[model samples]
Target chain A: MIDLQEMILEKDRLIPLLRKLKKESRLIAPVTNKHGDTLLSEINNIDRDTIDLDRQPQNSLKSFFLPQQEILAHYSVDTTGYNFTAPEAAKETIYFGVRSCDLTALLYMDLIFSKPAKDASYYDRRNRSVIITLGCNDPFANCFCEATNSGPYLDYGYDLQFIDLGSSYYVAAGRRKGADLLNKWDYFFRTVEEEDQKIRYQLFLEARGRFNRNIQVSHACHKLQEEEVAETIWEKLAGRCYDCGGCAYVCPTCTCFSVDDMAIDDSHGTRIRSWDACTSSGFTRMAGNHNPTDRTRHALKQRFLHKLKYDYQKHGKASCTGCGRCVDICFGGVDITTFIEMFTRDAS
Target chain B: MNTNFIPATAVIREIIRENDTISTFRLELINKRVPFSFRSGQFCMLSVPHCGEAAISISSAPNALPLFDLSIRNAGELTNAMHQMKAGEQVGIRGPFGTPFPMADFANSDMLFVAGGIGLAPLKSVIDHCLFQSGLEADAVANITLLYGSRSPSEVAFTTAISSWKEQGIDCRLTVDAGDDSWHANVGLVTELLQKELITKNTKSLICGPPVMIRFVIARLTEMGCASHDIFTTLERHMKCGMGTCGHCHLDGKLVCVDGPVFSLEQLQTMDVMELGT
Candidate 1:
């Protein structure tokens, strides 16, 4: 077995460490509000209790890599001539206190942007940043990460995993970057004992048992490829689908986008590239009366199959990380866990 | 710093009016600092100030002159403004983006070209390259056949050039959906021209047209013994960016702007065909 070590962070010291990390790079962490919910926001001042790593954020981690709106190119047109210019690259950022499920979602996104035809824009951001995951002590009711091969603990993607052990937190380095970070702040952490490591693993196991929901689909991509599921099933499930595209909007793995042209001046225009979801009616509409996926049922089916099947066939893993943000955000009560269960059960 | 973007200026050299509805513009780089090389059947994002931007395929062969050709149909706002542009006008051009037609994969196999209306624009690039290379070395290319169909005889693009190719003993066939008194050619849907005997064995095909026409032609080709992998088609999606960043051109997980505007039927099958929310 690999020798494991932990760096303890007392509740009082958490804020100081965050403030120190902020000095070097931008630190984004979860903050709660009067609504009793939390959101990931850039932290200028760190209050340890304000950071809630228990629940997944309402929005996806995708906005960190692929923003909702980005200026792609700027153009200037005049009596003299027209000039075109491309957009600038992103800055260095450290996404702190990210949930394990969201970090797994980032792994799927890496597949989309790191394929043979790599996306330079995504590569720029991915290369410039470090992922700091916080292990979930209390998973939400909607979460089913265990069913999808993800859990409360960090697997391969995260640079660091912070496991809360009551009075103090145990920090485990998952990557060289994490080790280097720990090395920089060696004074802040005392050497961990053998007993502390055992307790951390037990706490993680207890947290995993807390998750109530589970996905039933086994080998999700292969089931989708079989073509056994008919149109009626998709239509039936889609009856409740609102076509809001909230699922995709909140999914870290959904990489659909749309290009926009903004007029900067009479002689020039700025072309903006932004995220777009396939769940919208206008997603596949062409100029003269051609829409390959014109029906809502078809679009809904496409979203799920793309996440569970098409992406897997191309990237070797399911795009979904069972983050369950889609489940909680959907107004129509369209839960992917239920869908997977019904589809896989019927197939079996 | 501005990263992940390249801006290039192109000057309009020539414009060919293909009917009252559509026209093709030829553009050459003004900077001339970098040599722009693009495969046939690849598209670029063409931008006009204030009006908008559209994804247009480079209809000129790389082996040809430095100029690139963009065929515009006066169907949308950008094309409407583009139709009024003069030869000296300048436009913004980005990319030669997306995967090009598999020319190397089809080498040594007999080739068939079927195009309809403005769809002929993309196919023209591949045809030009084949013809140019074949003229230099006849044995290097397979037997080339062109079947071009348009709404009417007056709408046929490259009429003069096509006729010249025909005079040079290139197997060029023309058809019209409806013909006039002046028209002396076959009148029918393009699919009707795809009689089984017309398709040679061990042949590859390139098709581009209206979605319905493409679907019908593909069905006919499959019936006539052409494998899905042997046939290539160019798809036009609502693309805002020529790069894969925009989600507008996505069919399932595949972004048409990046993963393809050119896809064999086999690749397209992996996408979910149902409409959203059923």
Candidate 2:
């Protein structure tokens, strides 16, 4: 095996490096809030002890890629006439301390925007940025990344991955860009020996054991295709759903959006695109009285089945990562774990 | 400042008043030297300055001379403003957005067109294309029928053009919801006209109307031996933007703006149909 590249930084040196990076680029890191939950925020300075490596961040990484509100196109109407204009360009960003699960989520978003009909705006932000992931040293109670075939360490989709090793960090370069960043500052990192690799492996194994939740839906895409599964079960599962669209809002994979044209004046207007959720009642309401999926139960059923069944059939992977954000965020506490357990047993 | 949202200037060349509340405007792009191509059954987002925008389908054939036609029902703010305009007035047009009707799929098949009220606006594009003898073989127009219904004779759209097609020996059936003393056509809901056995087992049906009419017509067509794949319908939703970015027009995972405003019954079967405000 190749010798792992390692970096040794004194607590004082690490703080200074984070501060220096902040000056040159937009740097985001996980910081613990008053409630003890970790959230990714803009960091001007770093406290090594301030990093919370346990549990997924409260928010998904999608906000960095697809903002909540973006100007899609602009329209201006004047006595002379109306004109259409595209939105302004985006800025470069560096997302630091992202979790492996969230990084995997970004990779899935790449597939969505890079499809045959490409979304240029999404592609613009994604391609220009740098992603730095932090390995999870301790798994949370709700995390089921193991079940989703993702984990604590960056298997893929990160520029650089930092493994927390008590006094120092074991930095592994996952991409050429990451390697170049290290090479440019070669004075900071020292070569890691064979013995250091054993300790890192041990930590990974212990971290795996700490995770309480394990999902087992290996062939989720294939299982949902069985015609024998009755539609009545969806009705039963949907009974408890409130149709508030909270699950979609918190989901890392849900990418639905809506566009609106705001008339600024007679000659000028702005057409804005904002995130939309399928769980809302107005999602399918047509003009002059037509709505195909008008019922709350039906909308709820479609939201879950689309993520679990339909998207998998089309994209070759389930859209859900078993992050349990939807479960925790829901007002009704409608846990997806319960549904998965019930659906698997019923299908068998 | 971006130019992407700016609509091209198109002048109204002619206006055909369909009813007291509805009219079809024939618009010519000011720069007629450039070709503006759009398929039949595709809708455009029309904008009237100071009023707002509305999704309106192209009502004329692709090869129609001089100007393209937009049939507007003066119910909304944009359409109400549009009704006041006359020839030489300029309006903004965006799109030719959404998926158009699958013309190639209907080749060599016996076709049936069912329309009710203003739902005929979008279907008129298909009707014009099929009736035109330019590119299509003479045999392709055979075995076609149009079943049109309105509340009254006064509410019927494209009356002059439809009568001309009827005079040209096209099989056209007209009906009214409540007929007057002068009315000679079948009188009832548009679905009642289906009882006349105008369609055969081999006919492919296309239905467009209000939701209530579409649902009733679909049930009647199904009863008349129309298979799910052979039946197609157009849907209209609150489309704030013509792009799929807007979530308003979504029906399940499908975006009506992108996946379709037009879909076959086979595609609709996968969707969940529910009552409004439930």
DockQ of each: 0.49, 0.38
Give TM-scores of the second chain, every candidate. 0.92, 0.93
Maximum-DockQ candidate: 1
Candidate 1 lDDT over A1-348, as tens digits, reads 333445877767777777888888878888775587788877756754377666667775788887887776677777767776656777778888888888888887786566445676777788888788888888887887776777678766777788888878888887777777888887778778788788898998898889887566455567877755666767776888877888888887888777667786566677666777878888767666467665655657777777777666766667777788887788877657656766777744
Model 1 misplaced regions, further than 4 Å: A1-5, A34-36, A47-49, A86-91, A115-121, B31-34, B104-110, B222-230, B241-247, B251-259, B263-278
Candidate 1's DockQ is 0.49
Interface RMSD, per-candidate values to 1 decimal: 3.3, 3.8
Grade the docking of candidate 1.
medium
For model 1, what is the error of residue B133's alpha carbon versus the real structure, in angstroms, after optimal superposition? 1.9
TM-score of the A-chain for all models: 0.91, 0.89
A180-215, model 2: which lDDT tens digit per residue? 666766666666767667777999999888878766
Give per-residue CA lDDT, model 1, range B96-145, as digits (tens): 88999887776666888898988888998888887777755533467778
